[model samples]
Target: MSTEISPESAFPGPRRVFQKLNEKPLRDDLIFYFAIVAVASVLFMMLPLLTGETAEIDGLHLIWFLVAGTLIVLVQGLITGAVALLAVSLVEHFFLLFVDVHREFEQTMKSTVYALSPLILFSWAVLLKIPFAGLLFLAWFCLSTFFGVRIFHEKSKDRAVFVALATGVVLAFYLHRAVGI
Candidate 1:
């Protein structure tokens, strides 16, 4: 038998994750996309608690706030993530048009969502109030997106780098305005 390794059998890592995700059926990817968005939303909701934004309130009020706030943030974050995903995919597809590299919109969406794994998984560091934490995660997200675009779209390094940076800047601006960071 040939020794070729499929993406599904690759060792676990960011690269493997991206590869396997890119090859997954669209339905599976959508499920994973929502799962990641939900988890990231929960972590985002924890920010206020972790940063002591609710510390002044007493017991019952704090409990009420936590419960209500979590529900609101989760719903809001999921909606926002879905909208942003569509917008970003459209933007990236438009960008690819200029490069004469046509790809399906779903492919772009898959790349975008899978690339977000880094940010969704580890962006909680921002709540720690550590210096440059946001930037670090932003860089990670950008790098992952760069590779994803390259591998998924079969783009050259230059095109992938350009698209990744363009999208990364937009994402950074959005996060800065939304999160007040």
Candidate 2:
């Protein structure tokens, strides 16, 4: 794990980011996670206009679009993050009660955010008009959650796997609704 943390290096790629997430501090992952979300949200908000027919907008309209789009994306990202944190935390809290695994709320939140990387990409794909992107997103989401939960419960691999799968199952519906896919 690299101690030098920056959004670029910390989130160099999905695979690298997920791997580093297991080794890096929660604070660093939180920064990187939000940065990625912000960038993704902005790009997602721009996709329709970027991919659609060009529009005739004057300077004022263009400026307004940029400013309003940025604010909307950031606000949307914050709301989504809050919801995800609550959902993931609640799920983790519930499962932890049944299992003997010892982990903190911060750890669960960090892992959940990192696990959501694939879903973010899926949303990008949806914005880009990719075929069957929703299905792909679901697959990626399940795998990411499985491994993410597994990382925090190394003591009992069986229980970890079960909890992870359950998390995936429960989160799939919530995510599908949240992403509007």
Query: Which structure among the candidates has the greatest TM-score?
Result: 1
Task: Give residue 142's lDDT in candidate 1 (0 to 100).
Answer: 77
The deviation in Å at residue 126 for candidate 1 is: 2.7
Q: Residue 95, candidate 2: how far off, in angstroms?
A: 2.6
Clashing pairs in 2: none
Go through the candidates in order and give the clash count of each.
0, 0
Q: Tens digit of lDDT per residue, candidate 1, span 22-84? A: 778778877888888888888888877676675688889978988898899889978987887
TM-score of 2: 0.75
| lDDT per residue (tens digit) for residues 95-128 in model 2 | 7567775777776777677677556645777655
Evaluated with lDDT, which candidate comes out highest? Answer: 1
TM-score for predicted model 1 compared with the true structure: 0.76
Clash count, predicted structure 1: 0
List candidate 1 stretches off by more than 4 Å.
1-16, 51-64, 173-181
